[model samples]
Target: MDTSSIVILDFGSQYTQLIARRIREQNVFSVVLPCTAKIDEIQAQNPLAIILSGGPCSVYDADAPPADPEVLNLGLPVLGICYGLQFITHHLGGKVSPAPRREYGHAEVELIDRANPLFSEIPANIHVWMSHGDEALELPPGFHLTAKTANAVAGIANPERRIWAVQFHPEVHHTKQGSALLRNFLFSIVGAKPDWTPGHFIQSTVTAIRKKVGSGHAICALSGGVDSSVAAVLVNQAIGGQLTCVFVNNGVLRRDEFQKVQRNMRDNLGLNLVAVDASERFLAKLAGVTDPETKRKIIGNEFIAVFDDEAHRIAKQTGGVDWLVQGTLYPDVIESSSVKGPSQTIKSHHNVGGLPETMKLKLIEPLRDLFKDEVRRIGRDLHMPDDILQRQPFPGPGLAVRILGEVTPERVALLQEADDIVVAEIKAAGLYQQIWQSFAVLLPVKSVGVMGDQRTYAYTCAIRAVHSEDGMTADWVPLPYEVLKTISSRIVNEVRGINRVVYDITSKPPGTIEWE
Candidate 1:
């Protein structure tokens, strides 16, 4: 079945991606486009509905981005969010001005007209997350006030025109009935079908891979993480013997990761696998590269070089390979490309845009359109081991970025030991599954500490543990004091390089999950 979709017009809002994720949660595909996207670009998705995302800018600003006025005439259900509501009011001959009292957090909206389809089954009084300074003082000609809060008009709607606007963020988790409100708009207003599923994705993806590969030899860059492993398994299932998997040990892996992954691929996955120990080559190029982007680029280029060499060797052994498989995910693509509005390049993902331009093999990314959780579901459907499916996300550059300075064999060894302790302690505390990513970073600076009666100086290690639904946003995990103590003590006492241990308490907005 063709997946029904919704189009989310991003107005440079931080929560725009969350809006897309929420719609996808309802089993309807959602694509994000810039608010300035042309009318033709908006219609190309054949979306059942269009949603305007909230933004930081006001509608009255001289440089404020505007959607094509023709979008409202598209005859599709349209739901405008915070800034979206202000845009609708300002553009449709309604009055919009700065609210008498700005609403920045949670607020309650009383339904003034609950009969509207947008609030079909929602309660009369709903708590919502509000983050806006502008207020829609008057409704457009055909619109009526459907909801209101103490500070401003909460919502306005025109059932006949299938248009609705809300002055609060329904995409964030703070909004109590946000999901239900979105469901009403998606199913009741837009009449979209919920047909997207992991099972359906697996069947369709396998079929697609077979049709594209068509008995051609394919080489998969296996990182031993869930994404790449799942991609490798899916491709192997599609074209059994035509697939050859290459596992590169870049010398930046976690403690004992290379051997564990190599054994698992050989004994458990049972795929035709080859392990390349190019740690020295990678470490050599990464030497004295302190800049994070430069390190990422170096690692990326070296990876492609290793893969190219392997591809040539494999070709001589078994004809020629035509495809290079990667486990690139949706966030990687979105972050790497300006696909959804004017997005900042957060970081360059190793698998997404990191491939060298000179590569000759055709690319096959089976999991490119999927999120991490969705990829996990596909892995489970493929009967992958629970450990592999639930493993925490690791960067392709491995500990190179985590070291936060020049790469060296000694620093890599120190980090590996400290990182292993973190995992061991977290697993022992039974908090491994609850945490999204938990690891230890080896900071370059050394701190003084007392060992018995003697003073010692060693590298300081920082521990980071975060809780997140998706990797896009995260909160630092409030770990039990005892767990923290255990990890700190273990790292300082057992590991040779870490004298002091500190926890990262910052969240995603001001601080990224990684120190680098």
Candidate 2:
């Protein structure tokens, strides 16, 4: 283990990624691996410190995930979290059992050993975020209690062996001084340096990509969103003419998206972009599909088919296209599947899981381990345009998911107009950058409305706006009345075949960001 890196072992906790994110916020590099990772795998990063993430399983469960016991003897500084604390206790000849009063939310932990470097500059009693059912009942040999809450052992340490642990999560904002606690561990205890920056990442990644793709041809599936656009550029920088970017019009994109993206990527970014028009074919496939999942499957399947045809065509021209570059970010990986046994995934990412299983090309995902914010930093450092860098996330199925029912050429055009107006008003009001997603959904149900003294029935338009850190969870944005009025008035007054407008007021738990 070196002094520049940190390795976080995932024990199936959803917060494992958050732990990695928190450490990276300090400009130090950290990587996440499953708890089942071998000792040599952990040593591969030459990490300066190791973090054991909290998980859902009890320490005594039959299927409880296990860390290599050999990891404890590596002589590296170790910090164990909730389930982590229990794991260390169970492994080191200590007792771990169900807590009489399980802590699942906010609690207070009183620091008893104020002189301990782990608690240095922290308050005597601090509020922390807790989520666990088990607790350490007895300290392991050579371990000493450093802090305690009302009902459980809150903190423990063995400075001689350089191991520390806490029962509460220090990566969440609810913990108040959580950032400070993590910083203390990163700098004061582990003696790590702040050397991982945007320039550092780009330089290292380019070199790595170049070496990996030596004298090979690659093609990028560019969606023109922040993720794919950045990924395309990074790959282009690695192997200039050996890369081809394929942008397909799937018949459901936003207004002027095809043209705008082509111009920006080819003219502005200097990418070898190949624009494909398969609108008629995509629209034909989605003619009468209404079920949300069915629509996603059809679109995803059709997209892969089109991309496969394109890859083959390009391969014949360039001798070969051996690699497929995707913008698969960390959250996409987490949401698509389990980090380990204890982590629960909401749904398979349509962007990732929907890919056909028979594709033969190898994948080159440079941004696989990065967060969305970190990708934006790299984009800015690479001198990518603000329009591409600041654009909100667009779904893989495009307007097929936004439109609630059957997709057709006419419906797509109408929805595009309404969606365009909603976006324009949001951007005009200077809320585009502030809002996570603001778009219009065309509904199948229609209502009667008086238009210039003539009664008419038309499709209803629903406006959706949400704010989110990542697409995993979101809250509906409460747009101002004036902005809503402008959007509704414009959609009804200017765009024909639309009578009424509505706003979605539900959050992520009860309702997803998209209506479908």
Cα lDDT, all candidates: 0.87, 0.89
**Alpha-carbon deviation at 295 in model 2, angstroms:** 1.5
Score every model by TM-score: 0.90, 0.96
Task: Write down the lDDT that model 2 would get.
Answer: 0.89
lDDT of 2 at 387: 98
Task: Output the number of the lDDT-best candidate.
Answer: 2
Error of 1 at 353 (Å): 2.8
Residue-level lDDT of model 2, residues 1-516, one tens digit each, is: 233579888888878889989999999999887888899988888889999999999989998885687778899999998988888899998999999999999999999988788888999999999998889999999999999999999999999989999999999999998899999999999999999999988988888889889998999989999999999999999899999999999999999999999999999899999999999999999988889888888888888889888988999899887888989888766544454544553432455344565656788999987999999999999999999999988888899888888998999999999999999999999999999999999988899999999999998999999999877689999899999999999999988999999998889987788877
Error of 2 at 10 (Å): 1.4
- What is the Cα-based TM-score of model 2? 0.96
Scored against the true structure, residue 510 in model 2 reaches a CA lDDT of: 74
Tens-digit per-residue lDDT, 24-132, candidate 1: 7988888787788898877787788999989888888887886687788888989999988888888888998988899999899998896888888788999999998
Off by over 4 Å in 2: 1-4, 334-348, 352-359
